[model samples]
Target: MTDTHEKRITQNASALDLAMRLRQMISAYQVSQAIHVAAALGVPDLLQDGAKPCDHLARVTGADEDGLYRLLRALAGVEIFTEVAPRTFALTPLAALLRSDVDGSLHALAVLNGQDWFWRPWGRLADGVRTGSSVFEPIFGVHFFEYLQQNPAARGVFQKALAGASSRAAVADMYDFSASRRVADIGGGHGALIAAILGKYPQVHGILLERAAVLEGARRYLESAGVLDRCDLVESDFFESISAEADTYILSQVLHDWNDEAAHRILSNCRKAMASDGKILVVERVLPESGVQKGPLMDLNILVLMGGRERTQKEYEVLLARAGFRTTRVLEMGEAWSLIEGVPAE
Candidate 1:
């Protein structure tokens, strides 16, 4: 082949490859939805033991046989499942993560993603970007928290989603609870972090501050963690008052759900309720100055759903300073989150 002709052909092939990648990127949402559907239908749970035929899975899930087969085929292409036989599929390693009973399961997260409360707001992302306001209220006719308060089932799903995202074991080890006699987890839904900390430090007493509706679930989770007797589940609003004078206060993925002013107010409340020697552990995703990180996506999600934005370390420092606290240190947890330790300013 002539050099010029060969070069032209290679360029065309490269262009086609790039275009294919772009198309895949564009249709990524479809893949996410498909995984959600499989999880919602309990396909992964059903396939936990062994491979199953499409017809059987369809009958168990009350879905069309052909449709289920197509979904399984598509998911197999994505390595979420494997087609070991004709019209029969088994869970892949990735698919096993969707099983509800497994540790570190993404089942709740997948189910939440498929729910109306979570997905509908993404439809109004443009509105959120343009107005710098939450589209959730406009779309759902109520604040996100209010909606969760009214809908028990949705609230349960939301809590499970949070649990999946934040590892209690990781958060527990991120800080030193040895010095803390009383630990208060403010806005601690389900009390997972507190339970983890209290479990590790049996000498520490935990107090979980959450909404009245969520306290029941927190109680149940704490009890299951074997830390119920060491923890007190209190129903209160963090905005109004925390009403806890604990030496250590944990706000896990909490402040990121509000704008700067609101986040400052929350820190101010923590300062007000804190003991003189107390420290505030603000666990959140600290955004970088410039780069592609999951923090930006999480920031956009907060903006779309709750009118909140994730902050950088400097921003957290400023907020803590404004709230009469000093940023002592920031401990990188090696994940998307970090532990920002703040203490009462002298």
Candidate 2:
């Protein structure tokens, strides 16, 4: 072939690669939607007893048989469900978690992200990145928390989503809280972490500091968890007030929600409230070095959602050191998150 012909062939190959990539990028939403729809329709639960004919399943779900068949095929394509034979679908391990009644259900997350609240803001992600602010406010015409307050249905769904995400991880019970007797969880919405610790250590008591409205939900969760008797729920703003007394304080995924100046204000409040020998537990994802793929996909969210970030170990250390705390240790959790221990300096 002539040199011109060879160049054309190479260029065509590259074009094909680009075309394939673009298609995949565009279809990514569809793939997750399929999974979300399958969960919403309770398709996996339908197959729990045994595999059934597609028509029978569709009738039970009040969906079109043909449409259900296509959804099952798409889910199977993504390894969420498997078609044992034509028109017969069986549950795969991945699909089992989609069952709403299951203890480990991801149904809440599926509902939240698949619905308009999260999806709409995500659509404006580019605008957020460009402006260095949340498009959530622009897209919804109010802040996220305030939106939840006004929209009760959205609020319930959001709480369920938060609980669903919280359920998958190691809780405060899994940590060593022996160093401190009294603990405070600042902005600890729902109080799940503090409740987990109180349950584990009878001697340890905790206070959950959060907004007034969220404290209602947190109280419900704490009471249901059977830890309300031991844990105190204090409604306050971290920008204005943090609990003024605690032997140890915990802030999980908190600081990243704001810029450096806001983070300093929050940490400075915690510092003011701490005992002279208090320790701060900063539970957050420690961003890995270049080329490391991480969990929860929240780092990208930091860009689009809240303008926060996942920090490196070095960044946390420096941030704490500047705030009059010594970064003592970082304990790796099973997930991308880590427990960063900071103590007030002498």
Candidate 3:
């Protein structure tokens, strides 16, 4: 009944709340795995019409009925699904985005992240941080890209997941390409970004430079986007050299896959092949000085899986300066992406 006792009780309650919140954060991976299981089993797609009994879902997905019901109830607790009836579940707004047929579906993204091959490396993140090296090769016995090259199914899933992001068009709109005669997308996976650029600026020709393994998919994608004729697909490695010269170059989500030295090398290669008056558009996530951004977590994911780091704005400026380019400006493309524009230094 005293003021002191009341204050002490409030403080204790706050401490307990903090503890409870931290506990949820620590165990968030269980939710991710549950979503992955539901997506992998096409549960969202099955629920597209309406709510379905848990037993029916289990029968169709070939899952144990009791296990499926538990999974649904847990997800319902998180509001991903709704328990409309005793044993029936339906899609929540969040769950609808997991349906594969949707325009901006995250089905592939969910499936890819939960894959054992991709998930295992994240478990050894401590080793990666301690040694400042990629943990993927040690666990998989090969580089991530090489593993993708060898595993067709995984590569397909990865590419699909990347394509599902829907940022390429937004990236194209972030900058003006009307003045550019030719734009080359270096290390462009499946040429999606370039296709978006070509689609946006019909006057601007596009040249897609990537590894030989990627050109086929790039060709198919560009053709599907109706930009194949306007875009030239070249098979080459950016680390070694850029075979084509263009007035504008785009490095979309590419640099964050390598360490500073390697990223610098790729930039230098672009510098060499680019026209004297050309500009390079480095499309990537910019880590903020202070705040909660996906950039930091993605940076760690890159460090563990690809040995790369997400950089602050100043870091990108310094990195550009080292590669014989000067930072001109950075434009916001959308959430999760930024357009860092640089020109050859005088």
Candidate 4:
């Protein structure tokens, strides 16, 4: 009843709330791995029709019944799945997104991120921070892209995860391709962006320049999208040279996978291959200049995995200028990406 007593109670409650939140934050990796296991086991896909008993799911997924129950229960606590009845689980809205058949599925992402090859790099994140460089090559004895090149399964999962992360075709909605005669998508994984562009601009031919490891998948994807006929698949490395000449070049979610010098090389290659009055569209997540933001965590992830840092608008402008291009404008595409338009610098 006393003022001091009430104040003391309020302080204790606040401390308890903060402690609870911090605990959740600290244990987030448990949730992530659990979700990964569930996704990898096809639990979400199994439950797509309706709720099911844990035993049935276990039998289908070849998992132990009690172990599956425990996993589902823990995930239910995090709202990823819901326990509809005793030892029975159903997909939550979050769980639905993990189904491989769904639109915007995170199934591949969950599997890819939780795989030992990708997960172990985070354990060396402190070293990456200390050295101010990627820890992936040091840990795996190969660069990230090189590792993917050597591992076909990992490459497939990585490309699918990226394709599912965003609307692969959404970038076309933000830019005008009517005037573009030919568009070159450099290092375009699966040719999603160029396929989208070709789908929209029926007259624009596409040149997809990628490594031999990725060219086959890109061909399959572009073919399925019905744009393969208009797109040429060129087996080439962006770091060494670009053989395709086009008026417009697209580097979608590409540059952020490398350091500045490497990114500059890629851009300079585009500058050299593109037509005299060409334009480049750099599609990436533009980080904020300062303060707490959603991009820094990803920035740290990139640092740990690939030694690249997402840049602010000004940083991008300067990078573009160094590549012999003048940044004309930055247009907002989807919620998390921007289309930075540049022209050959005068």
What do the candidate models score in CA lDDT, each in turn?
Answer: 0.90, 0.81, 0.89, 0.90
Candidate with more favorable, higher TM-score: 1 or 4: 4
Q: Compared with the true structure, what per-residue lDDT tens digits does model 4 show for residues 1-346?
A: 9999999999999999999999999988898899999999999999999999999999999999999999999999989999999999999999999999987788999998788888898999889989999999998999999999999999998898887757456788878899999999888888878888898899999999999999999989998999899999999988899899888889988888888999999999889987779999998888878877898888898998999988888888998999999999888866667889999989
What is the C-alpha local distance difference test score of candidate 2? 0.81
TM-scores of the models, in the given order?
A: 0.97, 0.87, 0.95, 0.97
Off by over 4 Å in 2: 1-22, 101-104, 166-168, 295-297
lDDT tens readout by residue for model 3, 35-60: 99999999999999999999999999
Which is the leading candidate under TM-score?
Answer: 4
RMSD of 1: 1.3
Candidate 2 C-alpha lDDT tens digits along 176-285: 88766888888877876887788878898889898887888899999999989988889789988686478989888788777677788888888888888889989877
* Candidate 1 residue spans exceeding 4 A from truth: none
Clashing residue pairs found in predicted model 3: none
RMSD of 2: 3.4
Angstrom error at residue 310, model 4: 1.0
Shift in Å, residue 243, candidate 4: 1.1
Residue clash pairs of candidate 4: none
Instruction: Identify the runs in model 4 with alpha carbons over 4 angstroms from their true place.
Output: none
What is candidate 3's CA lDDT for residue 107? 99
Q: Cα lDDT of model 4 overall?
A: 0.90
Q: Which model is ahead, 1 or 2, in terms of lDDT?
A: 1
